[model samples]
Target: MFQVYLIDDEIWALISLEKLIPWKEYGFCICGKSNSAKKAWDDICKNPPDVVITDIRMPGMTGLELLKRLHDSKMKTQVVLVSGFAEFQYAQEAIKHGAFEYLLKQVKREQLKECMIRLFTFLSEQKKKMLETEAYSEKQFWTQMQDQQIKRAAECLFQIEKQEWIGKVCFVASCKKENIVDKKNGKMIQVESFRLFLLGERDENAYGLCIADQEKSSKSEEIKKFLAQVSEQETVWGISRIGDGTQKVSEMIWEAQTALRAAYFSQNQILSYHIKGNGWKKWDELSRAMYYKQNTQVRMQLEALKNEVEVGAVLSDELFSILERIDYEYKKSHGKNLKPQEWIRECDMIHSYPSDKEFFRWLMVFFPVQSEVGSDSAQYIIHLIENQLANAPTLATIGKELGMSQGALTQILKRQTGKNYSELLLEQRMKRAKELLVYTNKTITEIAEETGYTDLFYFSKTFKKNNGISPNEYRKEKRIENEQSTNEK
Candidate 1:
């Protein structure tokens, strides 16, 4: 609703206007009323209204004077002037002051209503245009501001000249699930908030931030309070405490990100603060051993494994070998016993995966791993079944072991594997029967019993479906092949 301010020196006239006009119907509400222009101007300045209806002449300040004041102040209030005396000079002055609608006090109610309607329409159109322009400008401004924030953050870290003044640097924390406040204006956006924050001093610069919105706290208190609140929020954060300005802020950013990575393995969900220690101060002693390190080669091998996974190629031992070498070099360089076995296990898991999508999903559950492959329900179900098939006597039993009802598993297996439980079982058993037929001197009845089919004729039918020949025919062919191989040898 449009807010309105009513001003008239005559108390009865103000009362009459208040009663006669259907203010709500015209999308208006008389937020305030005043007996003099001075008082009205004060009210308007404090809480400006959309429209102002005022008498043309008043004792302290005339309507013309009020209009001039509003114009000078750049208030975009729509004005309507009401006067008893219809002087030409007053009408000319009203027009000059951009009065929306001029009216005589003795005018008929119908005429006044018509004027009010026209004014309302005109004001409505102007409001709409203004809102559209504001929305458009807001979008553009926000986009540019975000870009500037990223650039400034990068400069604060990487640009060496900017680092000399910085006393300490901080990395603001965010989450994938939470909303991100705009770095510049703190405006809320709908996008998923995942941003890296960089704040540091330039040469000889120090700024303080309070934990709350009150007066700024001391630097130490600010850091402590910030860390305390972050802990209470149960939100994880990777932070670098006060450090020398000699090291680049960008390096701190990278370290902070690395800290977050390490934190991902913990259950705290809030690794609130971490500060890096000396970078091998025993440099000459460590540098002598560093020559034997294979850091570059290890990183390259990891990249190759990542590339193979990205393209949905089968995982190779080459990737595992690289991880092992990296593990070895890391142990030697840091003089900390790094677990090559852990890397070996992780590599085995990745390499043993049948497809990239499964590997990627497993990675997402533990660590962030990207595979440019989409999921297929059929392939996934088959893989799942294949993994669990060793524990059950039949496909139905396997489905039950996997927490699915027999019917649902049956339908899913049919849709995904293109074979119903019975058919799949028959195929598996038929292969077992063939192995018995060639490798062991088992009778047809014995073979049938061993393959989980008590009925010989039914077993033969299933054998034909799988091998394109009956059990006896398959056995005969195998015997002939075996005899020929024996003679050749």
Candidate 2:
């Protein structure tokens, strides 16, 4: 119900209006009454009422002056001015100062009720119009934001002059499909393949999912679920940290875009700037391990670095730098030269792997060991072995490639490397299996297939014989070691 305040200099006049007017019947209640216009003015300024009824000729500060004061203060309270015959001119002046209506000192029940009804209807219509205008303004602001009109968009989205804007955060989801529907309510704004949300608005606020305080467990879970629902195999999301009321929306958008690029390049589905620490130092450690040909150290460090990336511990530029440095260092050490097109294709394949271990396995194919015997035939044999490890090539296949008998190839391998052809092949297969076990998130069966072991039990027995542990045990040992090393550091 609307609150009404009654004011008059005479106590009898205030009491008569209070007792005669059935305010509840007109959807209003008299919240206060004053015999002094001065007190009424002070009360109204402190707690502005929806409707104010005041006499024109009060002891000090007449109703005309009070109405003028309210108009100057820009209060939304509607005022009804009352006057005696001596104050008719004062009532006209009250009207000029924005009073809702003026009434005689002797007000009838019907006349007062009519005035109250009109006032309520006007307030309702004005409120409806204001809400509609605000909705339109919000829509326009979003449209302008999509076009990146930063200054104009800010003007529409915030009431800067009134200081009414609150802090906000933005999220951008790049979906695999063009027409992805938002399962978490229809609050997300779709722009092309991107789904964007501003988190300060009422409808968009989910469990207080503000990016500024995303480290909180509840907020983190909300964000995780949101990303999972929107993301597919090729989809990812980026979130911007909290931006203050005055910060430009365009800058927030750019931050989110940068984070999204990081997620895309790192093959992680979600990333944010708010995560603590940097992954560059860990990445550098992995690079050093690779440079020194410490295969075990490299695998361990790579796994640690992948964990850091999944937790949003790296920036996009730093991750890219690490990747490029690895490529450059590998090419320099191996003395392998590739044409421009070939290098591009190889880089594409390296980036296509979803996990660090898979990427490491793909990279190992390029740096196959050259035979230490230094013979042209020996080098060719090593190349064949490296190229066909996935096929588990035999002595007969090597002899056919070299245009020699299997017996001759066997003698050459035994004399030069102190191991037979089958022993050498087993060593290569076991070495690859260990690398896959340490580095990839692939299952045991998948790793076995990749290493040319069709029988899971046979692969497990061979791995145990070679490494003194099963594949799963080896992975666990390496992971524990990585965790210990990380803790020590």
Candidate 3:
């Protein structure tokens, strides 16, 4: 039921309104009645009602002044103005001040009831819209945090100013499809397949911001019982340390994810940051080994890292960073080019794995060694071509260098790398051109010449055909991405 407050300077007017209006039948309860606007204002501040009805003219503080105060306070209260005078200016002012309705002093019961119904409907719709917008903003904020777009995430949080969310501990729970109840003041936000819960205060197991001292122990027991009721076979949770402010939301989320990964690895029902260890140093070592193509060292480091996780170490974002570095190194080492979309799909596949061991196994195949005869032969031929790339070696020059006929070399290349000599040469040249475009501020003509292409137009055509974007367009996109990344940092 909605609460309503009535205020007027005239005692008779207040009594008449209370006696005549069937507030209870219309889904409203008279919360407070005051003869002075000042008293009403004080009472509203103490306990704001859902709707307020007041006479326009009052001593000390007029109804307009009270409306302005309520608007400034940002309370979700609907206001209706009742006045003795039916002047156009008074009604216009009431509307300007956001009054729900302006009614004449001697209003008929039927007219008053109709206005009340309309106001109730309007409030209901407004409440729904506000909730939807808040939910959307909350979801967007968390997405931005995950993407490392800190500024954008902060802006989203600022828009949805929930003071309780500040300085709260964040928790993330991954579970099969099941309904989770909000027993505390904490709120649950759905993110893809996970539910993120922000706990402002904790009493043992109870997760909420508002709890009386006397009820703390009972609340904690209640929360523990609730968690015990959940099926451990299908649920895992990660809890973050207390957050400082909105700015630290991203950091807190990362911590929560780290804890969650640890829980998954250890097969625990719940994990907290206390169990998190420094695993990024090992991740960095693994990345460097992969970059230098130290196969033995990479394998050793990966095995050690896996052992560490099995014991208790939590996985960090550096895990994904290592995968990205491996992808870059794989392309550079093998002379294979993959589109960004393909790279993203590979990352998503890795992220879907439930444990570190499974992810490592996938990575082994993802960056396979060139041990097969076909792959080794392809790499050898590519190496020979790269050694004399400036000469723009033709099929005959390449075959002669390798002591084979052009026909034999063409068939071998096609069978191994799925591309003939001419296609491979073009692809190599385009890849070099792209590197020059991104790593060096060289003119298109100079880059084309460096890549063994004398004709700029032909070079551009081949680049566009191979990469689906022209050289200049690719450079511009890379620069924009770099700038955005810098700003995010």
Candidate 4:
């Protein structure tokens, strides 16, 4: 229940307000009470309550004074001002000081009740968003740490050091919803309000992790049942078996991922990590056939790979290597690559997971512009950076979002686009600044904020460095053409 604090100069009024409505019924607990606003301010500052109802006419410290103090101190405790006077100036002052609600001395039960309901809703949404963001950050940290050796993963997990989790282990699962395009569309599936941490996107799959509540007795079946409810048709979940604690999290993740891929053979359901596949032992045989252009043998070896991957006999890496080799060889002989999407379907085969970069490449493999072009990963990175420009997103933060480190992000961007991250970020911001200048009527300062520049002077200087003109000059020159175009239109 949300905590509530009540303050009034008159004892009668304080008791009346306290009993005006059933606070618990409305999701609040009247935790503290005071007859002096000054006294209440100290308690609130020491340990802020979620909601504070205070009399505005208190002698030592008026309700407005308390509200101002809370605001200046950066406390989120919401204050509701109550007074006998019905002055517009008091209401304005209350609003200016960030009072959650203002009520008269003769406040009706229903009016206060309605205000409590709004506070309840507002606070609930705030908590939910905070939890979700924590989930993202925790998963981001997990990914960053797990990429290191096992000891590092263990060290990171123990740093959590949650006493309740110390003796318990969770059956980690990797889940994917096939048709998801973006987080907005993809977040619709909630497995009975279970905690979820989205990892990242690859091809048609939006992948995430669900660490089931460790206290549940039948957590394995519990997770599987909930996941099955949301599976519908396009979702698949893979669960790692309950195992030893913290030290095994990395292994649990690997097992869940391998199990998720193995689930490709089975249709829409949850599968547990019970089987292990052979490593890339047959790649030599398949690669030899592809290099010799043994069309019949290549087809046969590919079929062999399909069987092997289906039954967990071989890793999926070899399977893709064979197909990519086939496509490359076919392009060599016929001057055209095998149509990937069509050939995959015609061959009636299953697929294993590829890295995000490879997946994007495969998406555009058949297009003519595929040659001498950068991967969509770079564009995705730039898009994320632009969206976070106001916060001045840096490489470390953006890299965490993509489950990559700053070094990995730098290497990939440089290798793919022949440009470093700062170059891309500056290019994106300047381009956005140019668009807003020519189109929007926002002030230069506003444009600077929009482009991730907090200092107006710095923004103008950088604009000149990149575009050979200050922001105002660029705006003047571009807006003429823009105005003429608008006039014609």
Q: Which numbered prediction scores highest in lDDT against the true structure? A: 4
> Which parts of model 3 are misplaced by more than 4 Å?
72-75, 148-489
* Candidate 2, 327-379: lDDT as tens digits: 67666764532111112322343455544545544544343333322355554
Q: Write the per-residue lDDT of candidate 1 for residues 109-200, one digit (tens) a residue.
A: 78767877786777778766876686567455434643665456445434533433334343333332232223353321111111133332
In candidate 3, residue 311 scores what lDDT? 52
The TM-score leader among the candidates is: 4
Query: Using alpha carbons, what is the TM-score of model 1?
Result: 0.33
Q: Which ten residues in a row have the lowest lDDT in candidate 4?
A: 364-373
Task: Assess each prediction's global lDDT (C-alpha) against the native.
Answer: 0.54, 0.63, 0.63, 0.66
Q: Would you give me the overall lDDT of model 1?
A: 0.54
56 in model 3: Cα distance from truth in Å?
A: 1.7
Winner of 2 and 3 under TM-score: 2
Please identify which of the two predictions, 3 or 4, would achieve the higher TM-score against the true structure.
Answer: 4
Model 3 lDDT per residue over 50-137, tens place: 8999998988988888888888889888999998899998888778878888899886788789988887777667765866696567
Q: Given candidate 3, what's the lDDT at residue 209?
A: 18
